[model samples]
Target: MAGMPTPHVSPGLYEVFLAVARAGSFTAAARVLGYTQSAVSRQIQALEDETGAALFERLPRGVRLSEAGRVLLPHAEAVRDRLARARAELAALRTLDGGLLRLGAFSSAGAALVPRAQAVFRARHPGVVVTRVEGPSVKHLGLVAAGEEDLAVVSPAADRPAPEGVTLHHLLDEPMLVALDRGHPYAGRRDVRLAELADEEWIVGNERLEDTLFRAAPAAGPRPRTGLMAQDWIAKLGAVAAGLGVTLVPALAASSVRPDVALVTIHPDDVPYRGIFAATPPAPTVAATAFLGLLRETAQELTPATGR
Candidate 1:
């Protein structure tokens, strides 16, 4: 006896079988599939040859399903339904209709950049769920590199390079601002030089001068005395409000500071602007790309054409 037909069938063969079964005739299935009647018959023949079972019985008027065809109907329908659902899910991801976008950012960016971008993203793609994590820029960068975060808003350190497996898109260079008491003489000035504030006590977030925001300032002049250390923004601003000392604030965060504190732009030559970026993996998700575009728009709105 001849060897049995190898059990091999393509999705297209099942599709033709389904069409012919529904239409009850090769000619009708051809019309539904936009293929010639001979082509439909050839597909059905191939499917039967592969399955080693006759799937249809010819009739004087049309055709009827064989016992094997009836047995296979539901399985073919299931495969067809599964493929359709898979296509829909892929489409949703492309269109941002559904998916999750994981985000990370440093403290200051949470003040405006990240929040504004997140608001716009949520408004546009309500189906996409966005979750955010806040911490230091280095931590966010590491999370992004490790694939825990889809994207991150970070002010990259000048001396340190981004971790491997990460790509950085520069958003802006934001100038540092001095957060002083309302009663401070420099409060009303358009800008102030660091040399003028050398005698003043500085409120810093880190105990080490190199780790604080002031590290960005040129090292030529005498370092301001950092007498107070307050890791929390509330404590730092509270100290500044009471005229205890002044702390450096990123320009991105200037809008969210307390009204009792004054924000004075530091001279460009004194403390250089910090470089802000959106960090992502080599292949970012569609939602991450959309959120990054929104971040760029918000960054532009916050900075003047002349540059901050």
Candidate 2:
């Protein structure tokens, strides 16, 4: 009887095999893994040559694993998962210095939370680098899930659930306020009712789902009509100042309102408060932890009365 040839597969070939198996097609795997389809095919071919057995059967649509391929699939998956975990753990080990901290944040938190935290963190540990991107809450959360960001500052919203393999640190429950042109009818009022503004044309933030916490008395009946939608808070505030429409903003954000605009409390019974949280991957680095601490401190300073 003829004996099987000795296997001589390389680690790179195994990685390619695992990617193809997970993705179910060379093209799909290449797209997900940032490699060319030809490269993936070559690696699989090399793997098959080394093992002296066919690993895949070419089909009209794609390819299917052969007997040899099926036999190695579990082992390949294990190797890939182990290598990924090792790389992440090694990166965490170099957390103190010379590592990147990729952070994402919603617009309001980007303006206040991230800046102050970065300032303090850089002062304390100058070796670590900080990178930040600002977007809506849902987008920030998605980045965290996709491993594009190490940490994020996001508001908890019903539609945007926390991603897997991530942890959340509740920072503070910030009250929402109505921003109106200084000459608007409710600008001087101590508090405004939801019913009073139902018919008013509203300028809503682009992330309306996140800002909906400010829509007081939503459970009661009709809510304010959204006439304009802006992604940036500054633009929304500008719209409010231009008398385009009323907009709701976080109290912390409202603290820095323009001279032409005023922020007034909306009754709590009508509009409920929303919380801000510092979110990160399950295993964040020392630098990330240090930065989060500074964020907490900055939030406290910003709202001394609440003490964060």
Candidate 3:
């Protein structure tokens, strides 16, 4: 039997190899792992030499994992995942008073919900640091899935399913409203029906989200002509206030609106309400769990006041 090659691969080398394989370029892997390209190359070479097998084949544009690398990739990934979980657990063992909370939120929740909950949580845990980021629900979910965020607040539209690998904590059912300039024809209406508004111009934030909810409306009709498309909720709200078109707003969003806009509830028989949920990473730290509990309590308090 051939003697086993001398093992030169350390845990650090395994990590670098995994990053290089995932990124497909030494430069990209270096950037992701905070290492220099030369260092990444050295680690891969060391691993290959120790194993007596070619781990990667250099290409003109980048690199491709060789047969040996393909065989090792899954095991390496499992090792990294276990190490990450161990590190998280170790960090959680530190003093609870000084831990950090990494949170993400969709636009409306960031504007109307997170601030209030943060204020209350900080008052109780003054030593903790709270970091927040705002983005669309899908983006927030992506961050949580990638381990960039501990928890995220999202509003799942009626037809959109909750994302995988996260535990959703239902907080409230926020009704959708039609936002328009105060002087618009539908502004003074107590409720707006989807059928009556089908012919009017609309300002939709995200087409996929709008379609997911609007298609399920009881009064679903021809899609409105999208006069302006906005990626940001604030911009969409501003467009609506400027009479660009009528746009849908959640109850939480309505509460944060400026005085120039009017919010009319969509008929219950029309669009169904959206649900506000707190989504946490598959495995969360103790501090994150505590903050989520506080968030749930705060959401309950804010729900009744919103008449949801």
Candidate 4:
């Protein structure tokens, strides 16, 4: 009689039992496992000793699991499946062919870079799963630092760079573009200056986001009035298209601009650019590294170094 007990039970012992149970004979189990019949018998005996239960009943013709064996059968099968899964996951993690990539991104990057990276990643590694969270870059930085996320596409404030234990891979500098209704007086121009739009109302996703822009443009004098505050890129762009006000659109988000709105570059000195980075643990997993490379490629496509 075997029972769960004092010393550790080797997974091998249960494996042997499962083989014997499946084959219904020690000799058959030995043949399948490439072990001698005596070896199979000894391993099963050891399992029975450890568990204090008879895992099989012997008849003149063959063998079958006893009452105790039936109880342990499912446990053995589960352990076998678990080990198989563990091996597969480890292999995936090593090769970047499978596993999950937990990614965090700020609003603009989520609107473009992260999705582009995810699509390319899935094409190359279909078995890998990607989960994403959207928030301010500062929040994403904390998630990466805490190991809650594998990595993030962040636009950390210049003075507040990567946190302790995390590293930043520079992606690109996204110059801010002004989103204005096509009907605005300066809409026909390819570029505009911050000083020109100084008195114009500003549209923003939220007050908090507006603060960042306002802080940077204090040199322009009074903070631009907030005529309308929309909660998402689409809403903000829509409002601008309706002649509500203007909002800043990152270069990363330029492609998603509304058809009726113009994304006009600002004068170089007044143009505020946010640095994009791939923040990760110093030694990221294969999946994270692979995805990071794809993100860089996507960033290049969005903001080419050629400066075109």
Query: What tens digits encode model 3's per-residue C-alpha lDDT throughout 165-212?
Result: 777888888777878799988878878888888777888765465775
Give a tens-digit lDDT track for model 2, residues 115-156.
878887877677677899988777777777777888898886
Per-residue lDDT of 1-308 in model 1, one digit per residue for the tens? 75875756699998999999999999999999999999998999988888778999999877899999999999999999999999998899999999899999988889988998899999999999899998888888889888999999988788886789999999988887888899999989989888888888888775232354456555754476767888888999999999998877778878888899998897888776788899999899999999999999998888883223
User: Which residue segments of model 3 deviate by more than 4 Å?
Assistant: 1-95, 157-164
Question: Candidate 1 vs candidate 4: which has greater lDDT?
Answer: 1
Name model 4 segments beyond 4 Å from true: 1-4, 19-42, 54-74, 204-209, 220-222, 227-235, 305-308
TM-score of each: 0.81, 0.63, 0.63, 0.81
By TM-score, the best candidate is 1
The lDDT of model 2 is 0.77
Which pairs of residues collide in candidate 1? Answer: none
Query: How do all the candidates rank in terms of TM-score, highest first?
Result: 1, 4, 3, 2
The Cα error of candidate 3 at residue 118, in Å, is 1.0
Provide C-alpha RMSD values for all models, in order: 4.0, 14.9, 15.6, 3.6
* Better lDDT candidate (2, 4): 4
How accurate locally, in lDDT, is each candidate?
Answer: 0.86, 0.77, 0.80, 0.82
lDDT of 1 at 273: 77
Give the runs in model 2 whose Cα sits over 4 Å from its true position.
Answer: 1-95, 159-161, 209-211, 214-216, 219-222, 228-231, 304-308
